[model samples]
Target: MQSIHFISGLPRSGSTLLAALLRQNPRFHAAMSSALAPLVSANLDIMSSGQEVSLLMEESQRPAMLRALFDTFCRTTTEREVFIDTNRSWCAKMPLIADLFPDARVIACVRDVPWVLDSLERLFRKNPYENTRLFGNDGERATVYSRMESLARHNRLVGYPWTALKEAFYGEQADRLLVVDYEILTKAPEKTLRLVYDFIGEPWYEGHDFDNVEYDAPRFDEALGIQGLHRVRPKVAFEPRRTILPPDLFKKYEHMDFWRDTAGSRANVLATKRATREDTTTA
Candidate 1:
């Protein structure tokens, strides 16, 4: 691959929208979450097992085999020169990616934690007839507290990406990360895309109509019993509204965004803060 990057971070945080916008560039190939990470993990387990067949494989060949797996999985026509793989788990696999492709970067799309949960709640309320596949078949019947608890648990939505992002933010490979705030992205897509292209060392391209981009997989959403869950509107404007959650619940995570702090590097803290001020003033 000429260029490879990973799109990860919090769920319901504009990852899908970012992928849709990136695909507008003919030179880039971007999509929703893929199965490459889980497939690679499974392959590692199978190869390292204590079975007799495992003894024949040398440790030196493992890296090549793993690299080949990604190369084969992401291979495409010559028209596409850059590939953006989307998966929330990629943040946790940053070390492995850095080791395999030293020049690869990760773009983390993030938003407020309360808003993320609220978005999920809004979907749940909208599709009352179908149980969301996110928390299994019983998601429809799950209470608000239960759903929140499940999301806050380790390896789940709020827990996994938050932990993994913090790890990458403070780790040695922090320079290889670009933290994109959802607020800024929706409010100023051109500026955000320019920043992204600059970070990736690619020539900036125009002609992307963020206002009319359509991104949704109806069949896939139907399979998950959550239609319109991944849908993005035709425009990129931010619609400020009241929180769907109770006051207490909304306040619980109102200050949960750690990227807003001054400590985290490789983030647009000032821009995010400015966005927050503008949002508040508009509200």
Candidate 2:
């Protein structure tokens, strides 16, 4: 089977752009997100139901069925040799993924919590004609405080992914994870991609042109009343802009990114070293 990896982390953290640049390599297959995780969850629920019929199935059957499900879902018609499945939920499913695909890795794209919320709010204002499904379809009409509260609550975008990423970061599967910062990725695409290639044990390809990459998910975004939510600009450069959020609201999450150390440097060195050691041993 072709190697499979996961792309997850906080929303509005450039997962789409990363996928776009990675897809530029003809040997790779990647997208904004996939339904495989939710599908697997739904199937597991059915099999684990307390009903007598469900109880009849052996415990071993569940894993085998899920393995088959992923194999079938990731199977492609093209010659793409690597599959990078994107989804924020995957951060919470690291244990399951580790058990299923022992060699698979998860590349988590992350950014400051305040900026992530700000990015979502900016998009909300840009599409004033329709309400986004993000906050129950009334995100635009909702007050800033209310919207912020909803997103910061546990199990939501800012909450769930942040908690999940941290869980995996400090958990036993930390070595199988790679945290990519939004600032570094946008400001230095080539350097970041090289690090990613090294982490995933893929041969480096210098053909990537971050400046002209194109990516968008109009159908998915439109269905959620978020027109350009998943869109990536033609260029990969980061243009600093003023925050649209209230000062208090922004301050509440301004210092919430836990992936960085006290000195504000990325703190996943241990995980990176482990990945390097594994790559070296395998190579």
Candidate 3:
């Protein structure tokens, strides 16, 4: 069975960043978001079901739609073994997607809650354009943001809904799931990429040779008329954040010891160190 790899996470949690890095694999045609309309239309089951999807996508029949999608994805792209799609909202629907492609691989990106919340707030407050396609309207953004945080609340005791979902869907299953930290991937691109390549069963590129390869994400958004929302590609360098959350908010959000347990003390240490490093760098 072939694997359809997915990169899922909270919006602004660095899904695109990870996707761009993974796309460096010469054998993969990484799509920011896969188009399911044609595949869904070909399968009647998807058309009939009136399931409401996330703000970013319309829901379709799970089994049929996913099969058709994988089939079409395999057919259209020259790459035979694996193809990648990075969609943050897909994290919420991992169970269904896992059912769709039983053999698929997934990378669930994660960041600190305060950072995620702050990004959500900024995205809503400063959407440069009032474009429905990009920001999905202020009301919708607020609702979706609320829903995500609410979902996050469910595992409040452990603070590991996202990580737990990733694990349940992909982890400890032998050959399918790999969780990549946003901070590590961004800070130490080479080491992380090597690990990812190995996990996907692909050879490391020449000296991790992703240097000049272009991953213009806007190529996909442009066709959908939602170009204003994302960064256009050809990005070659990592720009670590130089800003830090206020001390009070940081303390409040950072108290989730569960994050350390699930992500490991290493990742937690890196996340905090990176945040502090950025503050110093900026100062």
Q: Which stretches of candidate 1 lie over 4 Å from their true place?
A: 49-54, 76-79, 137-140, 262-271, 274-283
TM-score of each: 0.90, 0.89, 0.61
Better of 1 and 3 by lDDT: 1
Instruction: For each candidate in the order shown, give its overall lDDT on alpha carbons.
Output: 0.77, 0.77, 0.51
Rank ordering of all candidates by lDDT, starting from the highest: 2, 1, 3
State the weakest 10-residue window (summed lDDT) of model 3. Answer: 274-283
How does residue 124 of candidate 2 score in lDDT? 73
lDDT of 3 by residue, 1-283 (tens): 3456777654455566666666656666565555643344444333444533423344544465568666766667655456777654444454556567665666666665555645544443454453434333455345544423443554431134455544444334423445555566655668877777776667777634445434445555555444433452343345555334455554555533233344422121123232442411100
Estimate, for each residue in 152-224, the C-alpha lDDT of model 1 and write its tens digit: 6677767788888877777777778888888878888889988888888889878799878878888888987
RMSD vs true structure, all candidates: 3.1, 6.9, 7.7
- TM-score winner among the candidates? 1
lDDT of 2 by residue, 1-283 (tens): 7788989988888789889999998888988888888899888888887866577898889899999888888884345899889998887898899999998889988877777887777777778888777786465347888887888778776889889888877777877888887777877789899888888889998789977988888999899887887888888786666777787887787656566642333224312111100111000
- Positional deviation of 210 in candidate 3, in angstroms? 4.7
Better of 2 and 3 by TM-score: 2
The true-structure Cα RMSD of candidate 1 reads 3.1
